[model samples]
Target: MSVYVGNLSYQATQDGLTQAFSEYGTVKRVQLPTDRETGRMRGFAFVEMGTDAEEDAAIEALDGAEWMGRDLKVNKAKPREDRGSSQGGWDNRGGSRRY
Candidate 1:
């Protein structure tokens, strides 16, 4: 399981996240998504720790805690929902069949 960390500063970096989370336990991975168009940090990250206990500790310690000028939203990362194909739309092309 991974931890979802939100409300991060745009300047937050993978190294910074790793360092912060490492205090709780071993930080296995840190994924900071970037905006496709602008190529900027998305203000959130996913941190995978070595153990569930470490993740729990990080979440409990960081949630609602101020860091990098923002209050963090730390929690368990939820499974990604599958967005099925749009081929079944009204027009069968992902759009409404309007007049």
Candidate 2:
């Protein structure tokens, strides 16, 4: 299981998260997503710990705690939903329409 950390500063780094969470237990991985177009931190991250106990400890301690000048929102990460194809709203097929 992974923990979802939200309300993080744009400047927060993976190393910083690792250091903080490591106090609870071994940190397996840290993922901080970035904006595709701007390449900036998305103000959130996902952290995977060695065990669920570590994740619980981190979540309990970090949730609503101020870190890097922002209140952290820490909790278990829900599985990502599958967003289907990229085809947008417009219909491509040409058809005659009488107004």
lDDT of model 1, residue 38: 98
Estimate, for each residue in 1-99, the C-alpha lDDT of model 1 and write its tens digit. Answer: 899999999999999999999999999999999999999988999999999999999999999999989999999999998776545357546777544
lDDT of 2 at 32: 99
Q: What total of clashing residue pairs does each candidate reach?
A: 0, 0
* Candidate 2: tens digits of C-alpha lDDT, residues 1-99: 799999999989999999999999999999999999999999999999999999999999999999999999999999998764465453345643333
Say what the RMSD of model 1 is: 3.3
Give residue 63's lDDT in candidate 2 (0 to 100).
98
Model 1 stretches with alpha carbons more than 4 Å out: 85-99
**Where is model 1 poorest over a 10-residue stretch in terms of lDDT?**
84-93
Alpha-carbon deviation at 28 in model 2, angstroms: 0.5
Give lDDT: candidate 1, residue 65.
Answer: 93
Model 2 scores what on Cα lDDT?
A: 0.92
